[model samples]
Target: MIRPSILLAGAVSVFSPFVMAQDDENKPWTVSTELGVIATSGNTETTSVQGKIDAKQRLTRWHNHYIFSALFKEDQVTQDDGTKTTEKTAEKYFGSIKSAYQLESEHSNFFVFGSHTEDEFGSYETYSTVAVGYGTRLYNGETMQLDAEIGPGYFRGERVLEDESIQRESGVILRGAASLAWQISPSAEFKQTLSVESGEDNTRTVAESSLSTRINDAMQMKVGFNVANDTDVAPDKEKTDTMTYVNLVYNF
Candidate 1:
């Protein structure tokens, strides 16, 4: 089992020196919360909910980001005995933290990243990774920016089998990621991100695209699509999963 507390504590310890040297009062944290919900009745009964929190802090030489998100869905189904019941159809939780130290260059940094995920109905029941890498700005323009990173990492995960058995897998991995952000207008923004982890046992890939339009100074509406894929999976499981959501975001 990959312990989240251990990884978080390690990250904090690695960055404690920078944290202590910087004056936190002058550098405030920025946070955003997003929520999406859906409910249906009548012919078909279903409910779905998603929530996310994103936080960031910037000091003189260090930048930190934290993210947590959860999704849950339930559906009403008719059983063999002609009885109707509600059953959970999907459940997933994910969290990640990244801290970067600015180098002498204008847009370059060294970063440490850690993430964990739990999915009740996916190929992998639990997965976690830690990596250290160098990142740099690939493009800087008036309305668009791009950043990319590559690193060697380690990952451990639990895989579900066709027989309803759990198998543990762990290995060294090479990770690469990139992000693109475009300011379409003063109140509208578009973003895309992709990440891949290649290991001995399996290769995992994730991609997300989102567009947000500001409704006010502190609120916005966003629509996003996310996809996750694994090269290796159980016989009865699909290799890919996708989600589309519309959410309300509050920023502070």
Candidate 2:
């Protein structure tokens, strides 16, 4: 099992240098919280909620970020007897922290990243990965910025079988990630992120795209779409799941 205390200690050790580099008066932390929701009624009754918090800190030669997100969904059906039955369709959460140390080359850095995910209704009950990789800014222009990273990683997960038994799988994986941001206007921005973990047994992929527009000094409105795919799944389980939602974001 992965221990949160160990992760916290590692983060503190790596970020201590950056902490000292920044002046106390002007802290380098940036934090944001977001909430998304969707509901449907009539022929099909469905509801979903998602929440996320992101925090980052930047210093002279290092930048560190932490992110936490959760998603929950439910569907309801009206029986012939006039009773409503509700079932939880999805529940998942993800947490990760990444720290990058700059290299001599421009727009290049080395980073250590670790993440944990749990899903009640996914093919996997829990999954964890740790990787160290080189990341580079692929493009930086007036209105666009893009970054990419690739590395070897370790993955461990417990898969849910059709018969309700859990199968533990652990192996080496190749991790790849890319992110792109576009500044559409003074108050509107678009962003996309894609991540993949390829192992001998299965390949897991996630893609997310969002557009956000400023609503006030600290609030923004956002629309996002996300897709997840697992190449290997239990019998009768689909390989893909997709979601669309609208959200409110608050920046601190």
Which number leads on lDDT? 1
Give one digit per residue, the lDDT tens place, for model 2 in 110-229.
Answer: 999999999998898999999899999999999999999999999999998999789999999999999999999989999999999999988999999999998876678888999999
TM-score of each: 0.89, 0.84
Best by TM-score: 1
lDDT by residue (51-157, candidate 1, tens digit) is: 88887888788989899999998888899999988889999999999999999986899999999999999999999999999999999999999999999999999
Clashes of each: 0, 0
Please give the lDDT score at residue 56 for candidate 2. Answer: 85
- Stretch of 10 with least lDDT, candidate 2: 5-14
Misplaced by over 4 Å in model 1 are 1-27
Mark the regions of model 2 whose C-alpha exceeds 4 Å error after superposition.
Answer: 1-27, 38-47, 78-82
Give candidates' CA RMSD values in order. Answer: 8.4, 8.6
Cα shift from native, residue 133, model 1 (Å): 0.6
CA lDDT, candidate 2, residue 20: 27
